[model samples]
Target: MQVSREEILHIADLADLNIEEEKIDKYLLNLQDILNFANIVNKQDVSNLEITIGSNEAKNVFRKDEVKVFENTESLLENAPKKEQNMFKIPKVIN
Candidate 1:
């Protein structure tokens, strides 16, 4: 599960990354560590375990949709630096 110097160089070339000669060893070590972790995960014993989507037993906790009008219009618009027709106005981005 170890990453080689050549593999690191190849990856850099594929990604169009300009990895310095000094940093090649560091990159190789980090890549090797990631592969080692993957190897460890692959060796896990999950034969007796069930394939579960989630661990939580609770169902959806969503509330009913409701629309309510704001009572205090003046208070809500008071903080706006640029207000236009009861709405906050922003500078036009696209032509």
Candidate 2:
């Protein structure tokens, strides 16, 4: 598609762009090239190809769910600066 100088100016105005008069020709040529490439891409054939969302042989390899218990509570709260009723305590954060 051939883009006219007036059309380029109108596009620039609609996009709120400050395009110089000398740069308009360059922008027009670039836009034409992009459109031509898009037209070429639109003519591609992908009829036999399958649409895959992720990697080809991907599976969720997760560990089995298991229950574990800790034997020490005092050792876990040793490094805490404040402790109350077997739990760590801190200053109020929200008003």
Of the candidates shown, which would achieve the greatest lDDT relative to the real structure?
2
- Residue pairs with backbone overlap in model 1: none
lDDT of all the models against the reference? 0.85, 0.86
TM-score of each model, in listed order: 0.43, 0.42
Residue-level lDDT of model 2, residues 1-95, one tens digit each, is 77888998998999999899889889999998888888875687877887777876667789979988888867999978999978889999999
lDDT per residue, candidate 1, 53-85, as tens digits? 778864788987999888998998999999898
Clashing pairs in 2: none
TM-score of 1: 0.43
Candidate 1 has an lDDT of 0.85
User: Candidate 2 — what's its lDDT?
Assistant: 0.86
Maximum-TM-score candidate: 1
Span of 10 residues, lowest total lDDT, candidate 2:
50-59
11 in model 2: Cα distance from truth in Å?
0.7
